[model samples]
Target: MATESRHVTEYIDRPARVVYEYAAEPANLAHWAAGLGSSIRREDGRWFVDVPQGGRAEVAFVARNDLGVLDHEVHLPDGGIVYIPVRVIADGENAEVVLTVRRAAGMTDDEFDRDAAAVATDLATLKQILEASA
Candidate 1:
């Protein structure tokens, strides 16, 4: 069965390479991705974030590549894994960052809407951070 999904995107006034480089770094997530956590830490080469729901979630990002894929998997404390698809697309002199938020199994409509809203806010935060730095 296909799950409901929404693409939350933000146009960042920065080069694709620059945006990708910054966003790809796990350490930088705390600066823009508050929905994930307020802070992130690396232990034994693994990235962990304090989930808002009260436990820590391990975030594993795909290996860096020339392609703009920033896909990652979040391992929840309850043994559930959520796959998040993210991408950085070149837009002339700027870049568009898109995050695909999927409605998890058995998630309610309100929950899905909230998830999308949080993603949108996070993307906007990313845009502000990158554009301000430029």
Candidate 2:
């Protein structure tokens, strides 16, 4: 297995604050995560999701917009962890959202590829949501 990182980004023609607010709210995850079956845990800053095809994962929010780091740890179904970093860069009224997913080590090729595809789909969904709201 090899450590790998994947990056996905989408540009939204909207105010950063608006995009940030929508993405930061966990309740909106299901709308933009491509049917990940997302739900936020009230106890911790955890987002639980069921993958598009199958399987489940949990993302524990590490740093949030409060610190300006949209980061989380994506816990795989089998107990492995992948670090996912996301950021929204604002330029005037437009904002770009970037999502970086990194597996430090011990992930199979198939897992990485599958996860990458899932992330890509989620990003597309995010773009749709943002544009729709704009």
Candidate 3:
């Protein structure tokens, strides 16, 4: 029961530590992740964002670590959960960010392609923001 997946990556011209630090912050998601809505808020020690699709989705990011893991789970309003696996790996003096987009059980080919394209665009946006700020 393996699901189809796509690995979208972006090469950021910044140190891995710097890229991870900025991206790990929940507040910074609005700057690059348009798929997650443009604003995020914290309430009762939980992070929530108004997803582009409609209702709010609770986001739970992995605990801060030195291993560059930025995985997170998005709890949909309808009770479905989506797990996103992301990472920042050191590439010489720069960094490479990879996000794995999994095709949902009932998702069509067109939907999967759109999802992957969105992830790619988000990664590119991340690259632009981090590089320009450096």
User: How many residue pairs clash in all the candidates, one count each?
Assistant: 0, 0, 0
Top candidate on lDDT is 1
C-alpha TM-scores of all predictions: 0.98, 0.72, 0.98
For model 2 the TM-score comes to 0.72
What lDDT tens digits, residue by residue, belong to model 3 across residues 3-113? 988998999999999999999999999999997776898899999999888899999999999999999999999999999999999999999999999999999999999
lDDT of 1 by residue, 1-134 (tens): 99888998999999999999999999999999999987899999999999999999999999999889999999999999999999999999999999999999899999999999999999998999999999
Candidate 1's displacement at residue 21, Å, is: 0.4
Looking at candidate 1, the ten consecutive residues that score lowest on lDDT are: 2-11
Model 3 misses residue 98 by how many Å?
0.4
Judge candidate 1 at residue 115 and give its lDDT.
95
Where does model 1 exceed 4 Å of error?
A: none
Every candidate's CA RMSD: 0.7, 3.4, 0.7
The number of clashing residue pairs in model 2 is 0
